[model samples]
Target: MSILLKASDLKTPMSASDLFSRTGPLVFEVGFGDGRYLEHLASANPEWNLVGAEVSLGSVWRAYRRMNRSGIREVRLFKGNARFLVRDVFEEGSLDRVFVNFPDPWPRKKHLKNRLLQVPFFQILSSRLKPGGSLFLTTDHPEYFEFSVQQGQESLCFDVIQGPPPPATLETKYARKWRDQQKPIFHAEFRCHTVIPSAPRPISSIEMQHATLKGSLENVGPFTKQVRRFEGGHAFVMEAYRELDSQGLLFKVISEEQDFRQELLIQAWPKKDGVYVSLQPFGDPMTTKGVREAVLAVTDWLVSQGLELDQTWV
Candidate 1:
């Protein structure tokens, strides 16, 4: 059911506050890194309500902890990307300020498309902002800084702010790391026009990730492998890192006899890592042979890749 947008309660919140209560306008911080800047901003401006959005559970927990530790109680935190959630839930003209600081640069040319400051995103943001609301942004990478400034300058309603957002009492992990690396920081601000351009694309189904994993799974894994509980998930999952050598191989498989929910993620920890294996989120479980063949096909492929028969060490 495509329920229309509404602010303050985007998805379920760890902490919820009436974002705009006529008492004070709300401020939103997208990609609120480690929640440090979020706490600083909220504490500094106690009158303006703050809403922090992040995709990582760790960051969400850190933000919650920061709020508790600082004894600051006037903020809301959400755990998801701001793209889809923002449009569907954030009410128009409800925000006074929105901050984006040092998002992933996605350095590869193909990956540059992954940036947040796209035509579609700016369109959605324009609608979310109050008439004169400001969007603040900062970046440490010179290329990204320039890209953001250019993107903001060309955006439909945005006018690149000449100066940086106000300094805060803290720096996020990346901010601190960049500072240590002695990288220069760039800053900019933008405001949407009275009537901004409409969004270029509609909201997409959640099946994107499911499809991504599906495409990768068919071509991933060691032909022969064994299952092991994943690190944080405590179940088979995808993650970073490479293998040491071609001594052994690991395989993770999951079968849930329930609905078509994306409840599984398989991975391999080969003594030798080639390309990272991406596994299907859901596999057909109506027949035992179907499951076994799916498993063996992946394993046989790995065996063909020269994996040691005795991979039990993995």
Candidate 2:
């Protein structure tokens, strides 16, 4: 199977060359639907390292299987929001090229802000590209196409160049479908002419610390559905699991801020002093306010379950 990168494996603002283990031109595909174009690019350019960000787990799995079968080792797949990966994970000016084929138009009037080709997105994307690097976009939706063009022009960071879609891009399922339906595909290249300052990402990391409590440990079992609200966001504990043969309990949690959300795991295990609680390392979650609230939520839940609080460094 092809190696897949989990969010936990990435450092904030990672080095693309180091991740690929080679220095070469780096390319990113925002929504590599069906993975056809991604595979084609990897095969066509052996000297280029490719990275893809996809939100759908099913799509990611299918793409991974295809890459493994094709023996394509120069590609990495990130399963999450492309914006998060681009804005938080990749270093500034680390990319040579970026591709977006048939992204969701969010056609409804109320949903326009959800479209990917907005002005803010253009500004952020431009900051990630090296000098002269370009963003290639192809979409079948006429309205989204025009919208993207207007946003690119307004951003002032890219010199928009109307162009034909790249050959590999045409291999994507959406591109072929649109072609068969006689829909004219709109293509535009946004060449970075000026450097745009990187925006600060609303993410932070915290040192995971253990807590001690003195109480009846036997009552500290699995918890049911519970929710907690914090200053910036809220957290919900969906379920809890007990580690066999150990006094460790793992809580599956969902934490959400206005613009970001993550599924995390928090653990409460027995220590010599008492019960230790902290965010689990397995999920590789970015430390955000919501995440901190999640840790606190779990700790507070334990206290509610009759566990006496001794000392906490969560």
Q: lDDT per model, in order?
A: 0.55, 0.82
Candidate 2 residue-wise lDDT, 60-149, digit = tens: 999999998899998999887788777777788898999999999999999998888888888888878888999999999889999899
State residue 167's C-alpha deviation in candidate 1, in Å.
2.1
Extract clashing residue pairs from model 2.
none
lDDT of 1 by residue, 125-230 (tens): 8877778788887788778778876776676678776675456621777778887988777777777665473432222222112101111222344233333332
User: For candidate 1, what's the RMSD?
Assistant: 12.3
Off by over 4 Å in 2: 199-203, 217-224, 227-234, 242-248, 256-261, 271-273, 281-291
Among all candidates shown, the one with the greatest TM-score:
2
Each model's backbone clash number: 7, 0
lDDT of 2 at 77: 92
In order of appearance, the predictions have TM-scores of 0.58, 0.88
TM-score of 2: 0.88
Q: After superposition, how far is residue 108 of candidate 2 from its true place, in Å?
A: 1.4
What does the lDDT read for residue 174 in candidate 2?
88
